[model samples]
Target: MNGCAAFCSPASTQPALPLTLAHPLAHHSCTMFFKILLLSAAAFSATTTAATTYKASFTQYGSTDTWGSGNCNVASTACGFYTSPGYSAAVSQNEFGVGPGAGAGPACGTCWKLTAQTDSSGNNLSNAGNSIVVQVTNLCPASGNPLCAQKGLTGTNQYGANLNFDLCIDSGASNALFGNSGVGLAVGSAVQVDCNQWSGEVVH
Candidate 1:
């Protein structure tokens, strides 16, 4: 007979309404308080956890000219791509571990082969894989002038151990790009056309 009486009445008298089971909005104060408590707990948990950061840095030398095609003239020529049509750069990748020691512990490892694509980026395409390294161990003591190379692997012929480092360029990949940019093609991201130029192409 009554509207509000039939809805919020005692459970014993009613056959039970289907709408009450799926109700999202709460008219009562208790439901609202429960939601607030849940939210506060979630916020506290997020604030206490540490965040992981990672970056992949790389340096590549692109080979353009077959031989010495460009003249040494610094004026009109300006040692440009016509002379050196490739580029090189340093890339870095970092991961956050479970600790506050600041980059100390068992040590992580990473290895990379230089990948190249024709006028594009993402997933090294075009088959010109020239890997390179930042070689920064010697420069470590020199202040903010080191590289993102394999840790514990520097000086002598230890480039093989560079697999532990987050960034690296293998001998095979570098050889391909060292040939001809117009032939093998240019990798998009780290290799800029003008900035990190390279010398002669890899001879066949």
Candidate 2:
């Protein structure tokens, strides 16, 4: 027989070849994996959009001793596991939408960016263009106290609206951010603030 004839075989005598199909379990797992990925992305988007911006005012808190154990009242411990410097603040219990000594206030340990400080007359102060960052370390602006109102805060109650921040004078934050004027944060000084739930923590 010729070489080509010898190498050829009848269709019926051809060797059998194995076939493989995708496993049902594997297919299911792959679909589930992709579903989880999409769900996580959606959750992250929601968190990013949750940051809120609102009008607020500022005042000076007394000595650092008022920090109550040095930990935020909400956390009940020094810095409440936070190790960053200047991580101190006093948020209005009412305005922040939480009860006093609740230790569950969302504003606790939150970071705030304060700027555009102006007097009751709406005239910007010397540090009008400057901004300062501080952390929430205490609860303040007690209801019906007029803490901000007495300090020259005009208009509605800052505590009622959760729009007040009583920064610690010992932190030197007043002079650093509001200028070294003989008076640190003159009473009734108005300021605009931006607060975020996660901006206060520092790794270093």
Best candidate per lDDT, number?
2
Task: Tell me the spans in candidate 2 whose CA falls farther than 4 Å from its real position.
Answer: 1-47, 64-84, 147-155, 158-162, 181-204
Candidate 2: what lDDT? 0.50
Residue range 1-204, candidate 1, lDDT tens digits: 244334443455656444455234423433556578789989987766433222223333222334433322112211111212222122221111212323322222111223334332434444444444222110111123133333332311122222122111222233444344433224322311211233333211
Error of 2 at 64 (Å): 9.0
TM-scores for every predicted model:
0.22, 0.52
TM-score, candidate number 2? 0.52
Full-model lDDT, candidate 1: 0.30
Candidate 2 C-alpha RMSD relative to the actual structure:
12.8
Cα error, candidate 2, residue 142 (Å)? 2.8
Q: Which ten residues in a row have the lowest lDDT in candidate 2?
A: 1-10
Separately for all candidates shown, the number of backbone clashes (residues 3 or more apart, or on different chains) is: 19, 8
